[model samples]
Target chain A: DAGVTQSPTHLIKTRGQQVTLRCSPISGHKSVSWYQQVLGQGPQFIFQYYEKEERGRGNFPDRFSARQFPNYSSELNVNALLLGDSALYLCASSSPVYGGETEAFFGQGTRLTVV
Target chain B: EDKVVQSPLSLVVHEGDTVTLNCSYEVTNFRSLLWYKQEKKAPTFLFMLTSSGIEKKSGRLSSILDKKELFSILNITATQTGDSAVYLCAVNNAGNMLTFGGGTRLMVKP
Candidate 1:
């Protein structure tokens, strides 16, 4: 089966601008999560949505937000962009949340370059 | 605060050699530990360990978890140039949020 898919493989935005990234989870999956990975660092959790509900949030600022749809697709929105915001945004999907039984699958990620 | 740390930030090894990567974590609630291999693009899943002391293996790669120690180790044997990538360790908390380590860069020179 096709894994998680993300849109806009690469993006460039000016300071203070906003960008929205999109993700389509694998078929039959019900959870979507967002992560940000800076160069030389591992991905940091941003947000998680399951069944169209916000199940978890990370230590990121309020400028970052996300939502899940009925079909289990998800979107990550970042505002007030800064050069520090330039990183690879990753989308991951998993089957319905269970106790340690769910395995997350990742997408190629969207490279966001904020200037 | 929740945190995950990996040792040997980077390592260089010969193609036919074997290498081991380590990861340790501290969080309020423990759930599972996951390993991913990142090449030029996305990070792909390698293994997920929920129970302690059991080993997971796939070809030249294998991993083991130590719940009592709150850590995990990934081993790659008979490495090849294609095995060069960043190995990341992440822990899922009770909230279902994942906290990731800084990652270890492994270079397998042919």
Candidate 2:
């Protein structure tokens, strides 16, 4: 089985532009979450979708939005991108296991550089 | 707001040495704590600790969580160059979201 997969290993965008990053979760996983990781920092959660429903959201501005398709793939859209938006966008997927298991496996992430 | 802080933002050690990373968190209705090793873009899962005192070990890496103190420690013994990476600490709260710390960068020199 393949691990979580992300598209466009690297991306470059101009300030004020918009961009969309995509992710395909591992097979049989229903929960997909997105995160932003700046240089030298840990990833910050942005949004999570479980079973095609918005499950959780971080403190990111409304400019950032995401959705999960019926196939369990996810897309993260960022509008009016700023230089600060340049970071590695990560997508993690996990299954809601019984007995309290919640280890989210991550993808290689898309490197976004907004100039 | 939920927060996670990691100590010793970066460390350098010779091969065969040992290292310990620390993580402390403050959150609402904490559920579990996790550790990950990030070599480049992706962070691979290391351990997910929910209960206190019980240590999770794999190879030379082991981690233990203390619920009462709201902190956790990760120990890497007999470190090898392969262990060089950013170690990330994260926590899951009732919100069903994982909040991460800034991470500790480990460099094992040969």
Candidate 3:
């Protein structure tokens, strides 16, 4: 089976611009999560959606938002991007069964550069 | 606040050498601890440990979790250059969200 897949592997945006990154979860998976990874740092959680509902959210600001579709796909949107917003956005999918013990598979991630 | 911390922020070793990576976490409601290997863009899953004592092993890599001390260790035996990457430790809390550590950058020289 294919792993999690993300779209627009690379993106370049300007400050104050808005950007959207997309993710398609693995087949039969109902949970999709978004994370941002800065250079030389581990990924920071942004949002997690299961069954088309917001299940969990991280410490990100209002500028960051995400939603999941019925197909279990997800989109992460960042508004009024700042230079500090530049980072690699990752998407991971998991089957949260048996009390969230399932392993999550991650995508290659979309590299966003804001100038 | 839930947090995960990794030790020895970075390490350098030659091939065939063995290395042990450490991860300690403090979470409100701990569910599991995971290890991932990141090379360039993506992080590949290595192990998900929830129970203590029983070690999980794959090939030359192995990991064990200790819920009592809230720490885990990843052991890689006979390391190779291909084993070089950023090793990340993340904790799955009760909320089903993953909290990642700063990661340990490993460099294996031939």
Candidate 4:
């Protein structure tokens, strides 16, 4: 079975531009989450979607948004990107069973570099 | 605010040595704590700890959660060079959001 997979392994965009990153969760997974990891830092949660609905969101700005599809795939969009937005965007998926003890598996991540 | 803090930021030890990493968290309605190992790309799940005192072991790596003390520790015994990586700790709260610590970068020298 394939793990979480992300599209556009890398991207370079200019400031104020908009970019969309895609993720395909593992088969049978119902939850997809997005996270941002800056250089030398751990990933920070952005948004989590379960059953195609937004379940949780983090402290990210309004420019950052995400949505999960009916198939449990997800896309993370960042508008008006700034230099500070350059980082690795990771997609994670989990089954969300057994009272939330399920472990999340992550994708290789899309490395976005905003110039 | 909900926060997770990891100790010693980084470590370097010789192969065959043992090392311990610590994680402490302060969050509302705590549910579970997780450990991940990141090599160069993405992070891979290592362990998910909920109940306290019960140890979860995988090969040479082990972890234990302390809900009463609001902390957890990961131990690696007889470490090998392949153990070099950044170990991350995250806490899952009632809100279903994961708050991650800064992570400890471990470099096991051969």
Candidate 5:
């Protein structure tokens, strides 16, 4: 089976612009989560969607939002991006039978650079 | 607020030497802890620990969690150059959200 896949391996955008990153989860996986990893730091959770519903969200600002499609694929949207938003946005997918406690498989991630 | 902190932010060790990475977390409704190895692009899952005292092992890498102490340690024995990467520790809380540490950069020189 194919692992999780993310689009636009690298993206460049100007300040105040909007951008959207896409993620295709592994087949049979129902959970998709978004994380932002700044240079020299680990990833920070942004949001999680399971079964086409918003399961969880992090402390990120309202500018950051995400949604899961019926096919279980996910898209993370950022509006009016700031320089601080430049980072590697990773998408992780997992199959949690009990709603949690399961392991996750990550995609290569989308590198966003705000100019 | 949930937080995960890793010690010795970075380490340099010669091949065949051993290294230990530490992670401490303060999460309200702690559930489990996880370790991931990030080479350059993606992070691959290494181990997950929920119950204390039980050690999870994979080849030269092993990890143990101490729920009572709110910390976890990952040990790499006889490290190889292939083991060079950023070791990340994350705390998974009841919300199913993972709070990740800053990560420990391991440089194994041949």
Candidate 6:
């Protein structure tokens, strides 16, 4: 089975601009989460969607939001980007069953650079 | 707030050497701990350690979790150049959330 897949792969945006990153979860998976990994740091959680509902949210600000489509595909949006917003945006998917989420799989991530 | 910390922020070793990476977390309502290897982009899953004292091994890699002490360690034997990457330790807490540590950058010289 194919693993989690994310798109654009690369993104370049200007300060004050808005950007959207997309993710498609693995087949039969029901949960999708977003994370941001700054250079020289580990990934930090953003948001998680399961069954088209918001299940969890991290410490990110109001500028960050996400949604899960009917097919379980997810999209993360960041508004009014800042230079500090430049980082790798990752998408992880897990089946919601017991022990399923314990082993969430990650996508290659979208590299976002804000200038 | 949940926090995960990794020790020896970075390490350098030769191919034949073995290394141990440590992770300690202070998370509320802790559920599970996980390890991942990141080459350049997204991280790849390595192990999920839930039960205490039980060691999970794959190839030259092994990991054990200690729930009481709230720490875990990852061991890689016979390290190879291919093993050079950032090793991240993450914790899965309540609300189905995952929090990560700063990661240990490992560089193995062939």
RMSD for all candidates, in order, please: 1.3, 1.0, 1.0, 1.0, 1.1, 1.1
Candidate DockQ scores, in order: 0.72, 0.76, 0.73, 0.70, 0.72, 0.75
TM-score of chain A of 5: 0.96
lDDT of 2: 0.94
What candidate 1 gets wrong by more than 4 Å, as runs, is none
Fnat per candidate: 0.70, 0.84, 0.68, 0.68, 0.68, 0.82
lDDT of 4 at B43: 96
What's the CA error at residue B2 for candidate 2, in Å? Answer: 0.9
Top lDDT prediction, candidate number: 2
> After superposition on all CA atoms, how large is the RMSD of candidate 2?
1.0
Cα lDDT tens digits, model 5, A17-68, are 9999999999999899999999999899999998999989998999998999
> What TM-score against the true fold does each predicted structure earn?
0.96, 0.98, 0.98, 0.97, 0.97, 0.97
Q: Write out the backbone clash pairs for model 5.
A: none
What is the docking quality class of candidate 5? medium
- Per-residue CA lDDT of candidate 1, range A1-115, in tens? 7889999999999999999999999999888999999999999999999899998898899999999999899999999999999999999988855444477889999999998
DockQ value of candidate 6: 0.75
Off by over 4 Å in 3: none
What is the RMSD, in Å, between candidate 4 and the native fold over all Cα?
Answer: 1.0
Docking class of 3: medium
lDDT of 3 by residue, B29-76 (tens): 988899999999889999988899989999999999999999999999
Chain A TM-score per model, please list them: 0.95, 0.97, 0.96, 0.97, 0.96, 0.96
Cα deviation of A75, candidate 4, in Å: 0.6
